[model samples]
Target: MALLGLDSALGATLDPVGVVLALVAGVFWAGYVLTSARVGQLVPGAGGLAMTLVVATLVVAPLGAPRAIGAFGDSALLGLALVVALLSSVAPYTLELSARHRLPAPVFSILLSLEPAFAALFGWILLNQDSGVLRNLAIVLVIIASAGVTLTGARRKAPAMSVEAAGTRRDDA
Candidate 1:
């Protein structure tokens, strides 16, 4: 929808290369989520966040380097970019990975649907982007829906733990 909106409002057309890049991004991100979830299970105590940053840095550098590196000298500019990276990359990655631990992959994808709402809200308050009562309400609706689905799923999974407990033999047995 956002892409459609951009196409309609801005007359922006994606070339074949752009379309391919977008598709590649979607595929890699899906893999990243699944791989993070698997690693999260193995490490037991480690956050999937560090892996996200590591992968992101490596991926972006090769594609974005000359221009991205050129802007790095000024402290103020560097700080701004770092702040954006943390907010856009770090927080969302952590939230997604943490949610993945308890939620099914489909449910995790649902929670991710609310991220645009957050981006919109931030843009409105910080950048004075256009926002109105309807937009705010839409954001609220997405958040509530995501939370309801996540919590309900968590509750359902909780009951399954009893089955595992029942399987454990007592020392007296």
Candidate 2:
């Protein structure tokens, strides 16, 4: 919605600000997940998530309606946003961070291929953004292809004495 508003208000098809927002979002999210896992190493379960939300709320506070807080107090849309945020942002972040600590990056990335499917399912259920069978099948195919790459890459036998301690290292033994 924010992106749609920006695109419409600016009369822009594609713009740097939008591109930058997307890039920054992806970069920060990747860092947030990886760093959250590291922070978990230092803290404990959900501590990193709590800290992330604290910082994120601080950053987004000014952008959220301060004066109209009472307006959203009983809004179904606001409630939906809160629920979606919990599921899409908070839950996924924690799960990905925890998984990144255990799974190889390629494996994790491949596992993330399922994200679109879940998102689509949620969109259909939550927002009624339903798609036809062909579109859904296409999405499934893409996910399967991505998973194939991840699985094949993870299964590759790497030579010994090659940065074995890294999280991305293969357990080829």
Highest lDDT: which candidate? 2
| Residue-by-residue lDDT tens digits, candidate 1, 1-173 | 34333443455455778768988988987896678767887765434568657866997788877777766777888899889988878776676666777777656667687776878878988999875555566667667777887777778877554655666644336
Off by over 4 Å in 2: 1-24, 37-44, 65-68, 71-92, 95-107, 132-138, 160-173
Prediction 2 global C-alpha lDDT: 0.73
Model 2: how far residue 91 lies from native, Å: 4.4
Backbone clash numbers for all candidates listed: 0, 0
Among all windows of 10 consecutive residues in model 2, the one with the lowest summed lDDT is 1-10
TM-score of each: 0.54, 0.55
Candidate 2 lDDT tens digits, 1-173? 24344434455366668879988998997996577657868876677777878898888888876764875877887788789889967886777667877887787777777776887798999999865565577677777888887777666755445464653555543
TM-score, prediction 1: 0.54
